[model samples]
Target chain A: MSEHIRIVLVNTTHPGNIGGVARAMKNMGLSDLCLVSPKLFPHPDADARASGATDVLESAQVVASIDEALADCELVFGTSARERHIPWPLVDPRELAAIAAPLKGKAKVAIMFGREDRGLTNEELQRCHHHVHIPAVESFSSLNIAAAVQVISYELRMAELADQAGEKPQWGTQWDIELAEQRELELMFEHLERTLVKIDFLDPDNPRQLMPRLRRLLQRAVPDKVEVNVLRGILKAVERKMESAEKNGNDHV
Target chain B: MSEHIRIVLVNTTHPGNIGGVARAMKNMGLSDLCLVSPKLFPHPDADARASGATDVLESAQVVASIDEALADCELVFGTSARERHIPWPLVDPRELAAIAAPLKGKAKVAIMFGREDRGLTNEELQRCHHHVHIPAVESFSSLNIAAAVQVISYELRMAELADQAGEKPQWGTQWDIELAEQRELELMFEHLERTLVKIDFLDPDNPRQLMPRLRRLLQRAVPDKVEVNVLRGILKAVERKMESAEKNGNDHV
Candidate 1:
């Protein structure tokens, strides 16, 4: 997971911030640092600010454009302080890390931060899959780029650490208490929809909004295999009971 | 609430950030600006960055030490991007607003940001009751000081707006559905302690530090009034059951 995580900085103005960025990344066990069109590289001020993270600076990869920096990356995330007028898939930093986790071995993930003065332009942000905003205090929402990087890196590191320990997840798979996998969850939803149709709970002709709401509710519960089985068992029992009652009534009549 | 907030900059070097700080504070409807031993002030760069917020600059309070800047403030919060050995009460910028909300009318609150290069020293951070770390990307966590101020101020403004809007709060106000006030929770805790003593679950002479542990547990829970009341009711029911059981046993004997 760590190996696939790439930190990309675009149009960085201050070499000191670049150096500080390197230090922040190194502290969090991430090494794939890429710079795009930095205004000043190898400045003395940046070297001074980098402290002991000189190795990160020395090994940094410089690219001319953001597209070039992220061309080979499977997932790209952009950090922005303000909401853009255009709509895009939005994820918090933690959620972004979770998305990145599964794709760790399969593809490289790039997290991009923009310049100090202007930040990532709308055109630049459009290249990324989603935008992650570090929710800040309403009174003061301007975050230093390096600080933003630290927060994102911390979330990534924590997510990676949690993945490594193989600890029983609060909502995911466990040996003794196995939860349904994503595929199973999807299948169950399909079965649920059919059952709802049979019971006339879902109007087959106009099942527009109900499915989304039900999906969200089920998603929140994150039903495990045991819970799902229990629910299905109850539904089956009810069906059998109704069938038995119908047979008895018909015989009596 | 606005009157009680003190925007503190510690060991600030650039005069521009000071002016920008003033500008950011004013933009967010905050005016209390405190500078702790700045390297330069009243510079042309600062005035230029301040824009029309010269009033905030002119009235800005200059202090020799952080202690002086925060002396009158009852609740102190420090901003840091890096983690330290000793853990203080860490809060995100949003969480800091919740912590500050209750003290709004009662006490002065100081939000301290450190030097641009080194950030805040651990010694300076000790004075803070809560340490707020802005979430950032791991690669470039170096946020500019003024930008940091802007973000923090924005959070405070949003929180205050929410408070004014009469929305159900997650952490502010005693009656908010999300969480009860700390004082009320503390009182409920005392009630639980008394009930425990009555039931002989707690020793009068030697409680063996149980109450402190219980307090810590409740603190961690951050129980709302509903949760607190539910727990209180359970305690009362248990006490009643225990009493009845003791009476029945005595009669049998």
Candidate 2:
């Protein structure tokens, strides 16, 4: 069950932090680790910090980019430190475990931890379907990278343990339809955006908050595979009608 | 509220781990820190690990024994990595938070972490009202001291946040708008059905399960009033686009 969960560290500066993360992940029963452009790896400091969990570090995957790290992941969660002006779907670590645990057998979940200093970039965060924020003190909000990993890993273990003990809280009725993966949702959004622009509903020049607002709303909905197909069908229909109208010289659009 | 909660480290061997614990506590809004006969105090390694949370270390109270460390506390929880032969009240970190957070203002709580090599002794365990275990992987159960502190501190913060929310909120900030009312939802559904039919995505003659499936998805989202309005506005835009397409007599629909 733990194998399906991947912990990705992005541009980690401190080798020791990477090692600490490995130990934390091993302690919580997780094994998959992906490093994206880490400043230092396989360093003595990291090995020393990893302690007995050196095996985790030894088996860690090193990749050049976040896209490469998350290529096959079905669900992607980015850890965010600051609140953005435009709201995004946000969940606490416990809530995150609740949402991710039930999909253990069906999905590959990736939790991304940013650099030790500044954390994930705005562009990097936009790639995620949801943002996870550790409810730390606002005054001293930034937690050590390894410490952040520990807290999240701990939550996941607790949730998994509860499941083993037959105490898992059922989150909504068992999902009848398979949930849409990251790539599938991305394609549907692209199609939807094209249709909205063609229909003159969305000004391509000044899209502003329209796309983000819609993303937040739909992401919160967490559409299933079938639902994504349905939404795409609507977009296709709109596109066909708009193309036909343009061919007929309707000009109003 | 956080000041009432104290974190105690007993016979800590590494000054670096002590500093790590301080940063973890400060990140979680905890301040009171007591050290029970730690091997080193005011070490450079400790300050370095504490990051910007050196204030937590500077103000830390160092004592000679557990009795002195937990002196005026009303409740004490000892972190135990190993299971004891004799059964005692054992609570996981989440359960610990649930039990302790309510005692704010009424009781001073002290949570103790034992040595890095071996957790609290049986005698020390007896001092605690309850034994708090982190529930790590049983095979590699021993977590780094600072990591353990981080997990426990995070749960405490989560519980306190939930408390301040009055009800167990979905964590983070509260929703800004009221949820869509039943009447508003029904109206939006009607509008949505009309748009789907006009776009030829949903056949009015034989809608089958399309409307029901979409309803289930959106209902699961539990959108707020503003979200409902945004959705309705999208539907209106789609309808207007379709109306123009139809009026142009280019209706391949």
Candidate 3:
């Protein structure tokens, strides 16, 4: 159950925090750690903080970008410390656990924690199917990066245990269709944006939050690979229709 | 509800751990903290590690003993990393929160964490009415004390929020009778043990697991103040009867 899920830390500033995250993940039975553009790694501070979980740190995959970290993941969750204006499907850690638990062996899940100072950027958050916020006290809401990971990882373990004990209802829908991977979703988003521009429904120059809103809508639906392909095919057909109208000098319609 | 609960760390080795625990507690909306004979307190390491929770560290109580830390608490939960031979009422962190959350405002609760090297001693474990064990992976079960605290405190906050949202059933049984406080339970145990020895039922020199077994039984019942009083009354009555029989030269009978 733990093997299918990965912890992704993006632009982490502190090496010690990376070590702490490794320890937290290992403690919660999770071993897959991916560091995306971490400021420091393979540092002594991280090794010291990792304690007995140096193996996790040693085996961690350090990637240059969030896209590379999450490209192959079927499900992605972005951790947010503060609320964003974008109305994405925001869930607490426990809720995320419930949603993610039954996906074990069926999907590759990636949970992303951002930098020490600023959390995941709006652009990074858009890549996630859901945003997870740890329910910390609002006044002193910011938790240590490792502590936040610990809380989420702990919930995942608890949910996994509950699932193993047959206490939790199977949350995953019995979809014979394979879910679209992150890279597939990215491609579909590109196609969507291009089609929206060609249809004159979206102003490419002044695209404020339209793309993000659309992303949220599509991400919430969690389209399968075939669904994504179908959506792209439709976008291509719309482009073809627009091109024919332009060639016939009837683009006004 | 969070106010009524205090986190107690027993003989923690590192000052940094103390700070980390404070941050974890504050993040989870818990303020009360009591450290029982930590190796170092008010150290720079602790303050550095506390992040923004310096207030919690500053206001933390430095007690002399676990008994002192738990003296006023109506309920005590000791975190154990390994299983003990004693058949006590053991619960996972979520289960502990389910049982502890409803006691908010009604009871003062103490959750104890032990040293970094070794967890709560058997003698210290006996002091707790119940034991909480985080379900970490058995092979690498030991968690950083702060991570452990974070997991437990997170559950507590989750349970409290769940209770507030009316999603959880009222778990606290409406007891008109006040529950036995830690000191009251301790006194009752002393009286029971003395009475047993007086009645030749328990030998003080070779008292193996008798007291711990009895403690487990009584702790599981979670007797109220009146119940503890009644039990002490019975022990007193038996002692009085034995004294009179001894005075009348019929001690054997």
Candidate 4:
């Protein structure tokens, strides 16, 4: 489960914060560290701050943007201390852990922390599916980026321990979400669209944006692997029925 | 409840960690910070790391020994990462929080963190009523002292919030061991051993060290309050029965 947890830091200005985050991740059994546009890298301060957890820094992925960091993550949460009037789904850190920690078995979970001073940009916040805040005295709520990472990492570790200790929030679906990785979902969608074209339900030349609309629908639906498999089965059965009908008509002619 | 909670760092070596502890404690609404014989203090690194939480440091109490640090704390818990061969009541951090957080209303609860290099020594751990361990990969389990404090503080805050949020929050329940305090258990053992001797079950001089064996057995048993009360009751009954048998010699008189 820890292997599937990724800690993403965006536009961090301090090198020591990167190290601090690595140390925190290792403490919490999290190994994946992703940095988006960090100002400093391979700096001595980071390694020094990492303590013995320098391996986390050494193996961390430095990406050009947030998208690259979160491409594989199905559940992405951004940390924000500001009370935005923008009306987003807001959760505190513990609540975030309760929802996100269990998903580690199902998909890659990314927890993104923004810059030291300003926090996550509104544009960056929009990319995350949920926002998490650390409860504090609002006047001195300026949690250091590393401290924020440490707080989230601590919750993640504690949540995992709780689940292991038998308080499992049952993921009892037959089409368990764990079976549907993002790449697998993409492949299943492609297969469905191709079958629709073969049966002329979707005319490749005169397709009035039907496939695109279907894509959007599927994206919103977020089907699990078993559901995706069931949809593909129906598409295959339609293609077989259409071919058999055409063959019988030719024989009669 | 937060006011009654104290975060203690024992024999700390790094100034930055002192600041880090303050920052993490303030993040979770915990303000009481106690440092026991720290190698350094009033360092710039700590102030820098504390960010806006300088108030926590300024008001921090510096003590000379662990005893002074925990003088007023009714419930004291020591955090350790290493697996110990000597048997002691062990609990995970969440369980520790669930049991200890509710006690803040009843008593001063202190969560003590050991040094960065060796963790709490055997003698130091003996002072704690219960031992808490944070789950981590055993290979690189050297969690910084500050990180340990942060993790426990996070759990403490979460558990308190859970109780206030109408979650019917459990106080460890199945995981909780309602053991008798050290002194109470000691008195019970003395009474039991004396009863055994009076009943001629255990000899006074050639007792062959049976009392020590009973002590080890009870330690491993970790009896809850009901079990402890039951054992004491049986011992008292045995002593009463022995006295009645002695009185039966009234026929000879």
Candidate topping TM-score: 2
| CA displacement after TM-score superposition, residue B104 of candidate 1 (Å) | 4.5
Candidate 2 structure quality by residue, lDDT tens digits, A91-201: 899888987886777778899999888899977887777899998888889999999999888888888877776543234556677778777888888888887787677
Predicted candidate 1 versus true structure: per-residue lDDT over A1-253, tens digit per residue: 2779899999998787787677667656778899998999979977875666788888999989887899889889998778789889998766887888667788899999988778899998999889987655444555556666765666676677667766533412122345568887787778667655644456789987667655643554455575555445434543443345445545554
lDDT of 2 at A232: 88
Instruction: Evaluate candidate 2 and give its CAPRI docking class based on DockQ.
Output: medium
**DockQ per model, Cα:** 0.03, 0.50, 0.13, 0.09
* lDDT of each residue in B1-253, candidate 3, tens digit only: 3999999999999999999999999989999999999998889999988998999998999989887899899999999989798778999999999999999889999999998989999999999999999888888888999999999999999999888774431112123456689999999999877766655556799987667656744564556676676566545544554444344443222
How high is the CA lDDT of each candidate model?
0.69, 0.86, 0.82, 0.73
Q: What is the lDDT of residue B251 in candidate 1?
A: 55
How well is each residue in B1-109 modelled by candidate 1, as lDDT tens digits? 3777999999899897787677667766788999988899878868876766788899998899875786566567778787665333467666777667555665577
Best by lDDT: 2
Which ten contiguous residues of candidate 2 chain A have the minimum total lDDT?
A166-175
Model 4: per-residue Cα lDDT over B121-148, one tens digit each: 9898989888888786677677766677
* Model 4 accuracy (lDDT, Cα): 0.73
Q: Which stretches of candidate 2 lie over 4 Å from their true place?
A: A126-129, A167-171, A250-253, B65-67, B71-75, B85-89, B98-109, B121-130, B159-165, B168-172, B176-178, B239-253
* Chain A TM-score values for every predicted structure, listed in order: 0.64, 0.88, 0.94, 0.71
Query: Candidate 4, A90: how far from true, in Å?
Result: 2.8
Candidate 3, residues A94-130, lDDT tens digits: the string is: 8898888888877889999988888988899889888
